[model samples]
Target chain A: MKKNRIFNTITLLSASVIVFIVLAALLFTGIIDEYNGQLLTLAGIYIIVSLSLNLITGFTGQLSLGQAGFMSIGAYSSAIAMMNFHLPLVVSIIIGGLVTAVFGLLIGFPTLRLRGDYLAITTLGFGEIIRVIMVNLETYTGGAAGLKGIPSFSDTGDFLKDSIIKFSWVYVFVIITIVIVNNLINSSPGRAIVSIREDEIAANSMGINVSYYKIFSFTMSAFLAGIGGALYAVYFGYLNPVMFWFLTSVNFVVIVVLGGMGSITGTILAGVGFTYIQEWLRFFKDFRLVIFGLALIIVMLFWPRGLMGTNEFSIVKFVRKYIRKEHEGGSSKPSKIKGVK
Target chain B: MSVMEAKSISIVFGGLKAVTNFDLKLGKGELVGLIGPNGAGKTTVFNMLTGVYSPTSGDIVLNTSREGHNYKSIIKLKPYQITQSGVARTFQNIRLFKDLSVLDNVRIAFHFNVKYNALQGILRTTAFYNEEDEITEKARDLLKIFNLQDKEKELAKNLPYGEQRKLEITRALATNPKVLLLDEPAAGMNPQETHDLMNLISFIRNKFDLTILLIEHDMSLVMGICERIVVLDYGQTIAVGTPEQISKDPKVIKAYLGEGV
Candidate 1:
């Protein structure tokens, strides 16, 4: 057992090192230029938010339509800290997440008692309320005019270095978010959370605290969304209340549903895919949104359960299956081989 | 000593009284059956005892063997808290977590007892692995008892109906309850299945040293295994005695067979 553990650790470390080197090579060589880097950074930010939202809606079976509200809290607070309190960038981002978590607990506690549609409506209202409050807080938030000239990643005055720094924060965070979310889903508390999604009353009778998990996931989700927001704020070097509107919140819900609610790999795929598609469709001008809408409808029509439908796509499992098949069926036709999962 | 007792519990919803002045005592290692016709509030009584509904006017005291903690007032407590107080129950409809694996359904019952917090869980700490592996072992042991060890990987919803019912019981036992309340375990079972389930219930009552309160419409099941039977009609207790006495009671007969007969 100890030998296997050590081997696994070695494999993971080497894999991480290889991925980091490859990504750095791409960025430094200007193979992934400024525009693509910016788009990828945005996609990574969205992926983090989607993963967090999955913790609440997919695993815990709670409908929350106010993710963008948490994001706005993170952005504004982080921006405020950088400009007003003169904190370092990382510390500001942490403040953003912590502040959003506090709001998550406060809002999630009372509203979570109302299940199903009631919770959805309450969260929808919450998203709008946060946006309206941002518009009115003229002093700190800059109200309707928005907060501008926030610290940018381009501190070295070189465009490539700026994009690299931004993408690095996003890449590291995307990895962190994935690790944490996957770890949570595989553990004991994760079982309790998923059990609640399966059947609340049954989970309760089986000694799982239904409400506590609901609140915990909501807070955890809000914290991650805030981190995404902080990243967004730094990427653009600006904070805008208009960016975190009701539509923004609903957009994430759409991504989560389209990605396959509980499937982490699907969310990452959809987040990056949609971001790339939207950015690349700039040639269509106003027609881009129509294409986007058509794509969503087509995907849903074909795969009603969304892209992955609670099934994860694991690269290791895929690789191992083919390797084992080759050893067992050496003379078998390659044409006879089927998709593993 | 009684493991759990409901002292004249009553609950009213607006103008209607769902359960009226209901009293039950579950002595240690006793297997008691609650029998009633449809709409007689048998489930309501179970609901009240499990803290799904707080009695409008009564107290439910559950005694625990844990040192220094003799009894807990389960009245007005959340359902999970009631389970934590050593009372676990299975539903009439076999409410297993359908999407989860059969093993997970049982493991979830061990949630309250796990010492590691969410941070430890997310961090993959040593304590988390120790507790998680222990839970998996314990849940597998429970599955072995129900002969569900082979089907542990199958989704709970994909299991055969009889196995699903058994899985529900296994899950309840995983909570380590002193008192186990089973609502209609034989609802959809065939005669052979029902017979096997009754034997299983008796086996667990002995193995786990449990006090069981069961609700069933199956007369033979009630009379064959139950040491005592409580009969209810129209939200009121019509009879309470051994199966022989309950079988002879005029009130129970009237409730089951009706006035013309």
Candidate 2:
């Protein structure tokens, strides 16, 4: 057990170092072009969104279609805070997340009682309601024209001097989001959430408060999505009601589903991969969406469990088994026992 | 003193009376059986006792704690709340967390007892690690009791039918209940497995010092294990007595065993 703990710490430290080196290298060398840098930032933001959605729809087994609504709430709230109140970028972003979390609780209270398709439809309606409210609130949200001149991190420090340096902030948020969500899902409360998904009655019998956990998962999902939205607003420097339409919400759900529904690493990979693929397919123009839809369908048909299928990619486990070969004393053959799935 | 008591409890679902004026008094460490034929409201009585169904009119009280205080009414509480109050139950259908490992299936029931909170969990604090280590150790001990330690890492769904039933019981026991309700625990078991289960049930009741309420259709198992039996028919108690007295009752024979038995 002591050895395992040591292995885990080592794996975490090594992974962090690798990520830091990669990001720093990208910034120093300016190897990635502006277009790719923008896509990378977008991927980071999408990863946050997808991970949050996975908390609700994947781990908690609640079909929520209102993620984009929560995202819009965050985007608008943070933009308004920074522009009107002149709050620091970090403070405004946090305010954005808290505000959206409140909205999540409100929507969650009534609609969480409904399950499956009914829940899905109600959340879809809620997303549309958020969009309509954003569009009609002309004084606060600038109505259909959208909110503009949202200050970017480039306005803050030496980050603005180089386009690649701006991605550093996003990468940090992405890491924070991943760590928080990963820690949450691997904990006792996380087990309760998964139990609810497996069997509500069973979960209740085992002394889990089903309703409370459901609301918690939903609220957390919204909170993280709101953070993602704040990042999106700051990165793009603008926000419109149309930018958070029903299709946007669907896009998040698609990302979560195409990644393994419950796999964090899968969602991260899919989020980044999907964003890059969309950018790459820009040449097709009008037919891009058609081809994209076809590709999704084919992928779904081929890998129905999504990319990871309820498995986690654990660096510690990999290191212990492969790199150190701790158990077998440096045997060349692979261990028969599979890792977590 | 009675560990659990229900007084004149009844529930009506719309126009139908599911369980009517059911009363029960379970003494500490007693092994009681609730038996009836099909559709006899056996599971409904268990549900009411566990707070799955709130009694429409009567009171349910539990005096599980060691403190010399008045018995607390539990009818108004939620199922999970009732469990925390020291009443735990197993399902007739064997509701294990199918995808979770057998260890997790049992460990999750210890959620209320674990001393770590969400913040501790997210931060991986010393308290969290200590509590988690403790929980894993306790859960392993529980699985060891059922000789399931070897299969601790196996998913609950992948277990054989008999082991699945055992896992469900293990999970219920992990809650450290004062009153353990077993809902048709021996269902779908072969005679050999049933015999083993009967022995296991008695062993756990003594080992845990638990007041057990058993629901079963098998007469021999109930007769062999239960010190006292309560017979029900169509949401009404037909007889309540020792196994010998219950088997001899005319109403019990007619309602449950038919004329020949």
Candidate 3:
């Protein structure tokens, strides 16, 4: 057990160092231009979006399509805070998440009682309703024209004010999002949440408050999506109802399904990969969406469990087995497979 | 005082009486059995006791302090709330969380006992780590009691039939119930497994000081372990007495082996 703990620490340290090195390289060497940097930041935001959705739809087995609604709430709230209240970027982002969480609580209470496709349709309706509200509320949200001139992280009187956009800000938020989510997934409440998905009757018999956990998961998912929205507002320096249409929620659902539901690493990888693919498919012009639809269908047909299914890829277990084999005088045979029984 | 009591509890489904005027009293540390023929509402009785279906007319009360309080009626409570109030039951058909690990099947029952909250979990506070580690160790220990320690990492669905039943009982025990309800626990088990299950049931009754109410089709296993038995036929109690008296009762014999047995 002690050896395993040590191995976990080593694996975590190595992974952190690798991410730091890559980000530092990108910053120091001008290998990535402004467009690439913007895409990377978008990828980071989607990582937050996908991971949060995974907690609700994947782990808890509650199919939701209202993510864009929560994101719009966050984006608009953060933008309003900055434009009207003149709050710091960080404070406004936090406010955005909290405001969206409140909305999640209100929507989740009434609609979470529905199951499966009914729940999905209800959330989709909620998403469209939020968009309509944003479009019609011209006085506060800048109407159908949308809100503009939202300040970026670099515009917050920071050291790197000369840079067009700060990649580090998004990177740090991505890291924080990952840590918070990974921690929740491995905790006691997380076990109850997953058990509800596996078997609700059994979960109830075992003393799990199913309704409470369902609401909790939905609320948390909205909270994170709100933060993602805040990031989007700052990244683009603008917001519009059309930008958060019902199709936007469908896009997030596609990313989550194609990435493999319930696997954080898979969602992160799929978020980045799908963003890049969309950018690359821009050459197709009018045929872009057709190709995108075909790609989704093909991936679903070939890989129904998505990229990772329900299994997690654990670096610590991989490192531990390798170290053990080397210590025992390594043979040509492979170390035992880990993370799956 | 009886650990659990049901008085005149009845449930009707659209004018069809599924169960009617059911009554039971389970004493502390006693192992009781409920036996009936197919479709005799044995499982329905268990369901009502556990708050699965609220009795349409009558009351169900729990006398034990399993929830750190004394004597309360659980008829209005939800199923999970009933479990929290010290009544835990296994299903007639095994309802294990099929995709979860065997250890997780037991660990999830211990969820209410864990001291940490969501904020602490997300923050990874010291209290969160301590409680999680403690619960994991406790779950392993509980598995050891059922001799399922070796299968801890196996998914619940992958376990063999007998082991799955044992795991179900182990999970029910994990809830630390004042009364443990077993619904057809020895069903589909071979003679050898049935015999082992009987001994295991008696052992846990003594070890955990549990008031056990089991619904079983196996007469010998029921007669062997249960001090008293309640016979049901057409959703009504035909007789309630010690095993010897119940076996000789005419109604019970008619209910089981027809008139001549």
lDDT of the candidates, in the order given: 0.85, 0.86, 0.85
Which candidate gets the maximum lDDT versus the true structure?
2
User: What is the fraction of true interface contacts found in candidate 2?
Assistant: 0.69
Q: Across residues B127-204, which tens digit of lDDT does each residue of candidate 2 receive? A: 877777788889999999999999988999999999999999999998889999999999999999999999999999
Taking the candidates in order, what DockQ does each have?
0.55, 0.54, 0.55
TM-score on alpha carbons, each prediction: 0.94, 0.95, 0.93
Considering summed lDDT, which 10 consecutive residues are worst modelled in model 2 chain B? B63-72
Candidate with more favorable, higher lDDT: 1 or 2: 2
The DockQ-based CAPRI class assigned to model 1 is medium
Best first by TM-score, ranked: 2, 1, 3
Badly placed stretches (over 4 Å) of model 3 are A1-14, A155-165, A321-341, B66-69, B256-261
Stretches of candidate 2 above 4 Å error? Answer: A1-3, A27-30, A155-161, A327-341, B67-69, B257-261
Residue pairs that clash (backbone atoms under 3 angstroms), model 3: none
- Give model 3's TM-score versus the native structure: 0.93
Q: What TM value does chain B of candidate 2 have?
A: 0.97
DockQ class, candidate 3: medium
